[model samples]
Target: MAHADWSDPTPAAGWTIAHQIAHLAAADTNVLIAVRTPEAFDAVLKRTEAAGSRHADLEAAAGAAKPRSVLLDEWRSGRAEVAAALRDLPTEHGFPWYGSQLTATLMAPLRLMEVWAHGQDVFDAVCAARRPTDRLRQIATLGVIGRELSFHAAELPLTTEPFRVELAGSDGRTWTWGPADAEQRVEGGALDFCLRVTRRRYPAETDLTAVGGDAQAWLDNARVFL
Candidate 1:
């Protein structure tokens, strides 16, 4: 994913343009570090959870640092640093994060989804609409991530059948991920789908649809880590 301009020119009420950018940067930095070092990441996660007590606070703190200008610069610099780190990572090298081991290469796509999804929160907070690109690749990847997480969180058996997830972009293009003949299907706009699984946007706020048993349950608690 290319770098998006961190500007909300005509932002609505509640937050300035800078706050949104800073928020994304803060989260990008944390995930970047976690993917790089498993032990350190796990320790940090435990410590943070202990400090916050509530999961909401933990999520909030990860992206709630103030002073929008500093946040913007930090986001730019941090993304560059993580991008370089990802370039150096070998395919075979794996790091444990959120209770799963993932290859280093997957970090880029994962972080891309994270930045895009959380960035949407800032957008909604500012009341601006954005038509996302043909990012089907990233959206599909995120669907898989969400599927795995939803299953793990619910402690449900992974269904033998596959799922078909389709997201229609703003340009009237369809981006489909997963299987067609599966136990479940979640379909909606790419941006809305991303937001829904990310838990940043509630089902009522987006056009997402969930079919089959446990699909809604899965979406309810989807996360990178519990």
Candidate 2:
């Protein structure tokens, strides 16, 4: 990634590779604040909201002021700080995130999802092929749990019935969610499902198979990020 062209645009619309890394760095800094100082995190949220500025906008502005090397250094340092904070925090501690709260355990996977998703943008910018890994199970699980949020985010009706998801992991093992006897089912590759749910790839572009109305609806509206 260091050797890649930071100014090059990625598949994520108007964002460049440097913007993606900067976004992650900013997000990691926010997470660190959320975990270490609740008041500061609240201030950050308030300031961003008051300015009607999204985190991405703030990140891009910040990134534009610095060179790629500085952004890379901040990103690396911010990640290490967040990691250490999460490691030292109690398991029961829940911090505000987006509009809700998450425990240390839950926050870790969300961070991983961001890293993997943004990493995809970087890879795409450089014309690199990204291989699926067992770690994607974390993202897949998050996507499944975000089913209701997906519907809510899209302002659609939330289905009461639970759907089963069976993804063929890169490790050649099936990662299953919900009940096996569920009426609605989603079956596909883990990477495809992750990308679809993250909105990195649309359902029509992926090989995922949805077996019922609810499952199909989920695929249509799935979003891992809140």
RMSD of 1: 5.2
- Model 2 worst lDDT window (10 residues): 53-62
TM-score of each: 0.70, 0.96
Summarize candidate 1's per-residue lDDT along 64-177 as a digit string, tens digits: 345545565687899898788777878767866665677757777777876776566656655667776766467556665767767877788776667777778767888776
| Highest-TM-score candidate | 2
Clashing pairs in 2: none
| Model 1 error, position 224 (Å) | 5.5
lDDT of 2 by residue, 45-78 (tens): 7777876746567667677468877888999999
Provide the lDDT at 87 for model 2: 94
TM for candidate 2 is 0.96
